[model samples]
Target: MAKVKLTAVCKVCGSEIELPEDVMDGEITSCPTCGTRYIVRLKGEKVELEEFKGDVEDYGE
Candidate 1:
């Protein structure tokens, strides 16, 4: 049997982002085109992507 691939559209660059078939919810995935990070959300048999926000680190200011 052949392995199936999952895909999602990038919200920033409108490109296709390939995902693993066993990808889990809350996993981080980035776009190759725009380098935008997204959080994977699995709802039943559907997959949803949400933009990820990173916390800024302070360098001893």
Candidate 2:
């Protein structure tokens, strides 16, 4: 049997974002075309992507 792949569209750059079959809720995924980050939301077999505006921590400093 062939593995099934999930995909979502990037709202920023209009690119297709591939999601893993085992993806969980609150999983962070980013757009390859643009640097926009998104948060994965799952509810009863429904999947949704929301823009992530959380602060980025700089550990290099």
Candidate 3:
């Protein structure tokens, strides 16, 4: 499988944050410095935060 390279930013601070070691569908991870959660959003869906995991296949499998 191809690795995804996603980038996230801190809303509180103007700091540029990148995706952690691994990001899941609902695993919430925080920033090491700003302590901000990396939330993910989808179009025409519900508003919620995402999860973090070392791999993507760990979701309900």
Candidate 4:
């Protein structure tokens, strides 16, 4: 299997989180800094760029 680069932003505290490739779909994880909760989803088989929109976009590029 290949490694996937996953990232998500904290809606509560505005923190950016970079998830590991193993962090699969339907998994609920919390932000390391602020403890904000989020769900890991797989919109496609490969990584999705459009997923990191809004607050999460800054840290990505």
Pick the lDDT winner. Answer: 1
lDDT of 4 by residue, 1-61 (tens): 8666677767667677788878667555677897665556668764222322334334434
- Colliding residue pairs in candidate 3: 26-51, 27-51, 27-52
Provide TM-scores for the models.
Answer: 0.81, 0.77, 0.44, 0.58
C-alpha displacement of 4 in model 3, angstroms?
A: 4.1
- The C-alpha RMSD of each candidate to the native structure, in angstroms, is 5.0, 4.0, 8.0, 10.2
Error of 4 at 31 (Å): 0.7
**TM-score between model 4 and native:** 0.58
The predicted structure with the larger lDDT, 1 or 2, is 1
For TM-score, candidate 2 versus 4, the one ahead is: 2
In the range 1-61, model 2's lDDT, one tens digit per residue, is 9986778899988999998999988888888889788888888767789898765453113
Q: Assess the local accuracy of residue 1 in candidate 1 as a C-alpha lDDT between 0 and 100.
A: 100
Best by TM-score: 1
User: What residue pairs clash in candidate 2, if any at all?
Assistant: none
Instruction: List candidate 4 segments past 4 Å from native.
Output: 1-4, 45-61
Give the poorly placed runs of model 3, Cα more than 4 Å off.
1-4, 20-22, 41-61
Local accuracy of candidate 3 as per-residue lDDT tens digits, 1-61: 8765555656666565566435454555566667766545533323334444344455436
